[model samples]
Target: MTKSARADMITVLAMQWNHRKVENLHKTLSMRFVKTTQKAQTEVDNLESLKQELNISLEDTEQWVLEVKQWAATDSNQTRHRKRRRLTELKKKLRERILQYNTIDTCTETIDTEAACSLSEDVILPWEAQGDMVNLRTKRRLFDQVMLVRRMEEEKVIIVKEMTQHCQNLRQALEKLDHLLHQTKDDIRNQSMFHKY
Candidate 1:
């Protein structure tokens, strides 16, 4: 081969080799990114489900407290024995509900860890990569997907924090209700004793 032709062939081969290397690297990175995003998505989905359950639990607890308060207030007019029996039932329900809240609290504790998931930044954008080994449009789409997942993760954290606070508040409220129930029971017992005397 002529000297110039041989040099040109070598240069072309080198370019091809570099391009192939970039292509392989890009493919590997993309696969990794896909896996990461899917994992993040799954985590988000799980958190969303947990949040729904938490919301339901919160509402139920609040309503339950209100119902208990209203019932105790009205029960003073009822016979003492009937009031005592009703209060006993309410206390039993509260114990079961506290158990449910404990389960939800456990889920929330683990969820914070799940939200710790992060995306790998060791990727080359198609436009920034050597030899255009990847499609810019494809890379952009992947980047968009990553951004979307990141936003969802951020929102999930905010929601979880808010709900955590709500859960704490609800727990305090439940404690108050429990104390009020005890007070109500004491009042009922005293009324019975007063009537007997």
Candidate 2:
């Protein structure tokens, strides 16, 4: 072969090799990106599931608190004691759940921040650019949902506090009534004995 022709062949081969290397690198990066996205999505899904479970638990706790309030309103000492015990347990459970929710919220926030950072840093790859808008919308929706859950939890805490205060007031009223009844009974008994004498 002519020397120029041989040089041209070598140049073409070099270009082909370089092209293959770029293709392989792109493929590897694409796979890594896919895996990272999938993992983040799975974490989000798990957080959502946990939030649902916590909602169910909060509902149950509210119901129990209501029942305890009703029971405490009655004048029975035994029922009051039972109500207090149940309320304590419910409060403990609520505290734990709240802590768990806080932890989850932190995690959700971290994931969201990471996603936002990644989105900003991402170059406009053909595959990623196509879904960029969709991903942004989804992240916004997830953030909104998390905020809503946090608000709901805050409301639950307020409701519990109000219920506890009401129970305390009811107990105090019952005690005052009992004391007056005893005093009146004693006065009547002493007057009757004086009359008999």
Candidate 3:
């Protein structure tokens, strides 16, 4: 074979290798994007469900408080004492739940942001500098994928923030309920003393 023909053969082989590498990298990146998106979606769903559950629990606690108030209207010192103890236990449980909710929200946000930023930053493939139309097309496609992943990350962040806000609101409500319970207990004690005098 002539020298020129041998050089051509070598060039062709190198191009084939580069094409295979680019293809493999693209597939790997696509799989990673899909997995990350699915995981984020699951986290958002779980947070929403947890928020709903917390709202229901808050309503139930409020109803319990109203019942205690009605029972207090009657002159039963023992019942008042028992209700006060139960309210304290409920307040403690609410505090624990609030802490867990805040911790989970922070963790989910950190993991999601880190994953998204890392993936987006590295999406500029080495093959992008090959200066061929084929590589150009591949680069464009990869860029679009990166944008989509970034958007998903932003959505996840928003959802986590909303969940955090809801948790804070619930915590405040519990604190208020605890304060009211303390007031009621004080009133009961005063009335009992008056009766004994």
Return the top candidate by TM-score: 2
lDDT of 3 by residue, 1-197 (tens): 99999999999999999878654654554565566679767655554454364343445434544544454477367877987887667656655654554477444422233322243544432333354323223333433433455577876566556556656766897999999999999999999999999
Preferred candidate (TM-score higher): 1 or 2: 2
Q: Put the candidates in TM-score order, highest first.
A: 2, 3, 1
Global fold similarity of model 2 (TM-score): 0.34
Ranking of predictions according to lDDT: 2, 3, 1
lDDT of 3 at 135: 29
What is the C-alpha lDDT profile of model 1 across 12-104, one tens digit per residue? 999999878654654554555566567778865654454364344445434544555554466554567786787667656655654555477
Off by over 4 Å in 3: 1-131, 134-140
**Candidate 2's residue-wise lDDT over 107-185, tens digit each?**
4422232233243544332335456243333334444555455555555555556556656766897999999999999
Clashing pairs in 3: none
Question: Per-prediction RMSD in angstroms?
Answer: 40.4, 40.0, 40.0
lDDT by candidate, in order shown: 0.57, 0.58, 0.57
Q: Worst lDDT window (10 residues) for model 3?
A: 109-118
Candidate 1, after superposition: displacement of residue 140 in Å? Answer: 5.0
Evaluate residue 105 in candidate 3 and report its C-alpha lDDT on the 0 to 100 scale: 48
